[model samples]
Target: MIVDAWFTVQQIDEATYAISEYGHWEKVHSFLLLGTKKAALIDTGLGIDSIKRITNQLTDLPITVLTTHVHSDHIGSHGEFDSLCVHEAEEDWLISGIKGLSIDIIRKNIGRDITLPTPASFNPETFTPFQGKPTGLLKDGGEIELGERTLTIIHTPGHSPGHICLFDKSTGYLFTGDLLYDETPVYAFYPTTNPADLVASWERISSLKGIYKIYGSHNTLGLEPSLLNEVKIAVRYLRENDLAKFGTGIHRFSGFSVQF
Candidate 1:
């Protein structure tokens, strides 16, 4: 374990680590997976502080940031990395910023709710999400090889048109992004969200085989693979009752909930 004033670094395994910001309301998590030849960083955390300060001490290997989506909270520290990869569907959003999301709202969300001392550099009033060109674009079924550890990209839209989940085949670890997580409801009611695609994505990930553990972008650090079964039941229930749409409110399940 590596202790810091801001980021909480937990080693998931010999080659993987979860870089988390627990002081913020969102409790964002960014993963670091090291391989023989290179490394992969999954979604940088809220840019309240420069995440690069922490990552620099973690590994010496070159890192390629794999964005889960283009949301402000998830891609906050994207500007710190040299190589960035985002889904093809959101190339414009990554380069030019999301069209409808207001910076005031973003400032409000990132500025509020804090339990730890923030860096002096973090001024919520002037805080801005990173925006630039992606080094590459990700697509469904794409494989990112980090030496012996290969990651499979699952295009699980609904949370956002470009929301994706990463699967580490060797470890059976599924990083579900915002598409699935416990506690606060997974949101899909925004103008940019698609509820139908969200439920379909739930159904798709629920059927994945050999998922030993599941990791979401928020809340609890990791989840049991059995949670996927509950997702299957939730998916069926949502479809059976036609509740997967905007203004449907919140649908609670055994371990998680989704808002449409």
Candidate 2:
């Protein structure tokens, strides 16, 4: 069975927020401090009507939305925000605003008559299509200073060539995009995910200690200290182990060829 449109928000800390995707759950998004003069949206949901409706209902605090990557689902909706930032490697997709990859996959999975309000899907007059101008170019070591808060830009490419994560050094909070997600990492059938790099990226992410609250692009951060360890174990396991040994669910996303 398929799922319908829906949105969810979770409070990460005093001011941080997490936004989720509409259907067939994966990749949890994080929004930081809507009330703090300048709030930062870590990742945008699929640019579907469900996400758009909920985004409008949320606090309108001169938001500065920045995507962790340019996967169809994470960035398609971001076109609505006037100004946002993204990793340099994915800046082209953000500017190009191409569709076809994840959009069709999600729609098919949902089995619903849904249409995203993007330039390709809808006209500007009908609804505001997200055509954001990128103001910041995120580098591997660059840091984003929003008001008093800061999110370090760590380039952990794997899921995509320029995938990034936001680390709040002050709070020791890590907001990983698709590069480090809770779901059994999906490999690229259409040339999006790079399996070899994804497994290695986990090693890089695990190096950071005292990471109190960790998050993915799909679900609320469960303070899963187990996640950190699990990631490390998963990495080494994939390096030597045959992915085919796992159940079909693990390989169903992209075949058993690539390990994550």
Candidate 3:
């Protein structure tokens, strides 16, 4: 196991690892999946410290960074990677930055709520999220092949216009990004979010077959596949009660919660 001052690395399996930043209040998690030919890094953690330092110690293969959405916390360490892939819907946001989201708010969020010491190199006052052209754009049914391993992109837009979830058929692991997580509410109440689309996305993913485990981007690291059943029920209830819209508050379910 590799140890660091800011990031905590945990092995998911022989070829997969989870790089987490527990010092931040969000407790963001970034995943690294290694294959015979290359590797895939799913959403870098908060840029409080360099994620590349941790990744460099994990694998020697080339890494393709897959952005879940254009959120600041997720794309914090994006500048450190060469090959980046984002959903087509967020291609503009990735290149030019998200519209209307001020840097002041971003700085406040990044600077506050710290449980551990950040690196001396980090200065939230001057912090900026990475903005550059991605090497490729991902689509709903796009497939990324890493030697014998394959990852299917599920365009689960709602949390963000281009928010996506990755499904690994070989291992039945669903990387839900911000679409699902435990402990904290999966929110879609932002101006860029669509409550209806979010609910539909939840319904879409809940019906997926052979999901062995659920790995969300924040909060708890892994969830059982049974939580999908609750998502199914929550979807029906939210739609039936006409609550899939803004200002509905947080809807708590058995294992997870959502804010519309």
Candidate 4:
């Protein structure tokens, strides 16, 4: 394990790591998957600290960032990396900041509920999300080959238009991003979110062939693959009851929950 003031690095395997920030309310987690040729960084943590500093110490392989979405918290340190890839649907947002979202609101959220001392380099008042052209755009069923290991991208939109889940073929690790996670309600209530799409995404992931472990971007680090069974049930119930719509409030299931 690697220790740091802002990020907690946990080794999932000899070549995989989970870099988490527990000091923040969101409890955001980023994953580093190393392959024989290169490494893929799932997402960057909150911009309060530079994640590159930690990545530098982890591996010598050239890093390519795999963006699950274009949300602020997830792409906070996107500028720190050179080769960045995002879903084709969110390519515009990566080039230009997400529209309709006010900087004031974003700043407020980033500055609140912080339990650790942030570096002086971060100024919440001036905080702004990264906006730049992506080096590559990914699509559904896309395969990212990192030498010996290969990751398949599943387009699981809902919480965001381009939200995606990465499935590592070698490890059976499914990185669900914000589409699934525990401890906090998966958000789909915002104007940009789609309740119907979220449920559909849940159903899509539930049907995946072999998922030995489930890893989300927030809250709890890793969830049991059995939770996908609960997700299937939740999706069926939500659709049958016509509850997949805006303002339906929070729907709680056995191991996870969603808001819309």
**Candidate 4 local Cα displacement, residue 143, angstroms:** 0.6
Worst 10 residues of 2 by lDDT: 248-257
Residue 60, model 3: lDDT of 96
lDDT string, candidate 1, 96-121, tens digits:
99897899999999999999999999
lDDT of 2 by residue, 37-146 (tens): 67777767755434445555566667777788876567656756666888898777777654445444545533344432223543323333244558878898897777
Root-mean-square deviation (CA) per prediction: 0.7, 6.2, 0.6, 0.6
Show pairs that collide, candidate 3.
none
Runs of candidate 3 exceeding 4 Å displacement = none
Which portions of model 2 miss their true places by more than 4 Å?
Answer: 1-6, 22-30, 34-36, 50-60, 97-133, 188-190, 220-223, 241-260
lDDT of each: 0.93, 0.62, 0.94, 0.94
Runs in model 4 deviating more than 4 A are none
TM-score between model 1 and native: 0.99
